[model samples]
Target: MYIPELYKNENAEEIKSFIKTNSFGILVNQTQGKLWGTHIPLELETNLQGKEVLFGHISKENPQGESFTDNNEVLSIFNGPHSYISSSWYDHENVPTWNYIAVHVYGKIRIIEGEELLFAMKKLVDKYEATSKNPVKIENLSAETMRQINGITAFEIEITDIQAVHKLSQNRDDKNHNTIISELEERKDNNSQAIADAMKKQRS
Candidate 1:
């Protein structure tokens, strides 16, 4: 999250969009004697304060969830598109560099169970299926199915701070930047290709 001025992303809407696209992030928390991290998908929401909030769940047996208490702070990292920009791409004799985008959200978690968890489940089902031709509504599901799904531990992170970095050769000369992007566009890797597209969009 230590983003240099050249790499910092100050666009609030872009940061939110990054989180939406890369919602599957590592949730890190420190407790008692150890620190733990779990990679899971999350639903983003706006809190009453109009701040980013993360809602996710874990298995009841996952001790990682119980650590979120009165004292623990949490951090979730959302890594977007990335690529390696070889020094060869640059016209000068500079070291190789990496071009990437990443966002980190810091907050405190409030663990929810029972009814709150149930509501979260219903919301998620609606979120994904609402746009489908045949929507699968959680509310209409059988009680047994609902019970099975809501048995896990659910939680929400009230995001207090966010840091984003988009190092897309912004500091480089136009020629070098174009060279790196052109190479990425020709690659087979979708991630790199996507990065190239995003960089091109930013440039325009």
Candidate 2:
């Protein structure tokens, strides 16, 4: 991730919360000497043995599924809010940059099937469906609809390492930092406002 010391975030709880909030991530792996990546929703969880892991699935037709062999390692990237930071907002002359948060997780793939796969799918569905006005339950699906699970490859990744970066103008002085937050908040876009909020939270 090439994170500088100034921008690195080492707080475990914070990083976990970030991942849960931004669970849709990019899963990267190599198959047949070619690197493949898939954008999917991953759930951070603890396995029966108390080891941290990520659970997700992809269609069986996806070529990336070929990479899910024994001992195969993979990389999952989770991105958070980001916004441009104009140098004009700083008290002194400086180059413009971007403020953002991201996480990189590396792990070994473990293909799951039978009840394990069904359980994983249930959890994934329940999590996202919570926000719906009329939330749908996986158990309520018809047999024909449930048959679609046969076409997917569900797997878990035993986490080996996690790297988190939070570049929110931490290098700036208090005056400049406050100014940057103000400028970001003035912008109407969601990313800008999110950066502003994150900066405030960091200071808090």
Candidate 3:
């Protein structure tokens, strides 16, 4: 994550909040001279020391879970909306670019099992289902279903480092930035709309 000083976001709380909103991320690691990656939705938690820890799980059948041994170093990437910024939107001559939000978390992995895995599952379900009209509850799950869910290999990572970038055309002048936002807002795509919103928030 080569974030320039101009685009770097140093706010720790903001970065954590971004990860919570975009909980689905790619977990990357290496083993046996090969690279492996798995897409998983993670839950964030804090230790008694107030340090951030990440919780997530992968199928026991997934070789990535087996690779979690040895306290291997792992990287999780959380990506937000992004869109192309056409040079045509700029007042003067310039090359095209992109605007987006991303966070990289590096940590040491440890596998968790038994009641801890069940607890993680309940937390995840409650978080995502909170906004639904018919929210799901852990008690609603049958014993067999809960056992099946527990079969997955849950893991926790005590995050050692974090890097975040919010590249929302901050390098451009006010006029150019506003122009890009306007054009993006007019576009029907969700990514463009999201970029526009992020740019507007940055401006504020």
Candidate 4:
């Protein structure tokens, strides 16, 4: 990612938290002269050895998985809050811009099959299903159904490089920043709320 100095975020902890908050992201890979991408919620973790790992699974029938063969690399992009800022909202002659947070992680693909797939399934279920109104118990599902679901591909990305950016009006002076924040707060949209939150965090 080519991020301007004004929008760049160098803190790893901040970027990691942003990724966790917005866990659903795009996993992109290429194979057979074609590009493929999968949009799914991924589980991110740091092991005892202090290495970052990304875990996710895809349907067996999904062609995106085929792109992640033995040695193919992959790029996973985590996009957080984003809102369009009109130049009219600012007090100066600044052109329109976007306020957003995003992280790009590049790594090698390691496919996990058979028992490993089952382990990945359990991990996913434990992470997402536990918070539901009527929590889904994977153990409650029939053995055959579980087996069928386990047929999906499970993979992990051992991230080699990571870059993140937080463009939350940090480049503007206090006056302009406050103006954009107030204008965004008046909008009844999720992105606007996020921009407001980011602005508050940055100012703090």
Backbone clashes under 3 angstroms, per model = 0, 0, 0, 0
TM-score of each: 0.90, 0.96, 0.93, 0.90
lDDT by residue (1-204, candidate 1, tens digit) is 788998888899988888887888998887556878888888787544465578888887788867777455999999888888778777889998788899999988888776666666776678778789999987788888777765577888888899999888788778888998888888869888988988887787
Off by over 4 Å in 2: 48-50
Per-residue lDDT tens digits for candidate 3, residues 60-177, read 8888887778547999999999999999999999899999999999999888776666666777898888999999898798888777875588888879899999999998999999
Which candidate, 1 or 3, has the higher lDDT? 3
Better of 2 and 3 by lDDT: 2
lDDT of 2 by residue, 71-122 (tens): 3799999999999999988778889999999999999999899877877888
Q: Candidate 2 — worst ten consecutive residues by lDDT sum?
A: 44-53
Candidate 3 stretches greater than 4 Å from native: 47-51
Candidate 1: residue 91 lDDT (0-100)? 81
Candidate 1 wrongly placed segments (more than 4 Å) = 47-52, 130-134
In order, candidate lDDTs are 0.81, 0.91, 0.87, 0.82
Ranking by lDDT: 2, 3, 4, 1
**Could you tell me the TM-score of candidate 1?**
0.90
RMSD of 2: 1.3
Q: List RMSD in Å for every model shown.
A: 2.1, 1.3, 1.7, 2.1
lDDT of 4 at 189: 97
Clashing residue pairs in candidate 2 (N, C-alpha, C atoms within 3 angstroms): none
